[model samples]
Target: MRTAFFVDGYNLFYGLLAGTDYKWLDLPGLLAHVAHVQDPASHLVSVDYFTSGVKPELATRGIQSKEAQDTYVRALKAKGVQVHYGRHQLDPAKAPRFIDKQTRPSRQDKVDIWKLEEKETDVHIAVSMYRLAARQASLAEDGRIDQIVLVSADTDMTPALRAIREDFPAMQVGVILPHRAGIERPPPGSLKDYSHWMRRFITEDELLAHQFPARVPTRKKPAIKPEYW
Candidate 1:
């Protein structure tokens, strides 16, 4: 059996940011753990880590290291995980903001452009899934890899999930929850029971071991902006 993996870097990163103590994890290293789950019967043909580039402003917020982020992107390529880049879309008013006034407070909501980057995971996954199957057509020509695994909880991927099964009929789909360690169930879909499979295997213990070290500590520099200047 041959398998290809698809991972959404943005979703996966925020997942760890919100819930885990580990700030960063070795992207490619973590995927290697998935490969370990396979037996001699299965071989890894590709690992696609779809992500958006970090913007300059948020890069200073300590969410993650831009340099290390770039390094990880490169490392994934080195390790054979195809890197798919896209611009993140920023919706106006991610949350809410308030302003003070003499009598009443002014409120405003605006797009958070600082974090926006290309977002095209769905397209990347679609193209990759089809290409992988197209490759070596005679080998397993089902228009999908032997086993298509995605590390996501997104329902957006349901279309791809359905197409591979109904169209190709030979490909298998599996969804793995990268967060919650390994206790969450995959979102319901129309994929066939045998053609599509779902599992939760990543654990907090494994996540900790694969996480990147805390970035180099730095002190805040004095601000040059004048108060009400």
Candidate 2:
């Protein structure tokens, strides 16, 4: 099977990589390994990673964090992963205040906060996946993509999978939830409904084995792993 991977970077990070030492990941290698594990005949032809640039002002390590993200992106690009960048939108918003686990959130009791949202990523992923499937539908049998694997736990992508199943019945859809093995998270039923197969969790050993080296040489400067990572 000729397979292509569409990765939601934000979802993958928060779900699996947050506060972990495996931040310097070799995305293509990891996905290829996962694909092969699922099906020995699976061949990864493309990897599209969707993400937004880090906002230096709001990042925990400030500019260093932004620099680290840039370095990682460069490394991914060097490895032939096609990266699509969205943008961060920071705005003033109001939401119900959280009191306690026993207390219900009341709309009347609200707090003003900075709402940071990643824009266009979900739409981009959906559109890109659909477009690829549509284009492949017209290609010769050997050139067409047999499977499209989504690396996200977000339910927002459910509709896209549903549409692909409807319009391109021959195109197989697979979902790889980014949840780590130790973390207990229910797989979204909606995503599973649209996908032919769903891989619920990634083991820590897989991540450890698929990390990039300390330094990846680029066309210009070498992309170095962050010291804090």
For candidate 1, the per-residue lDDT at 196 reads 50
Worst 10 residues of 1 by lDDT: 220-229
Candidate 1 has a TM-score of 0.66
With a 3 Å backbone cut-off (N, CA, C), the pairs that clash in candidate 1 are 86-118, 87-117, 87-118, 87-119, 88-117, 88-118, 93-110, 181-202
lDDT of 1 by residue, 1-229 (tens): 6677888777677654444554455555666566556444555666788888776556653434555466556545544667888776755434333444544432455334333545676778767766665564466354335777777666666677666666666666666655555445554453324235564456677777776433322233221211111
Model 1 spans with C-alpha error above 4 angstroms: 17-24, 35-40, 60-64, 90-118, 134-144, 182-195, 211-229
TM-score, each model? 0.66, 0.98
lDDT string, candidate 2, 1-229, tens digits: 9999999999999999998999999999999999999999999999999999999999999999999999999999989999999999999999999999999999999999999999999999999999999998679898999999999999999899999999999998999999899888878999999999989998999999999999998999989999999
lDDT of each: 0.59, 0.95
Overall local distance difference test of candidate 1:
0.59
Candidate 1 residue 223 Cα shift, in angstroms, is: 31
Query: Number of the top candidate by TM-score?
Result: 2
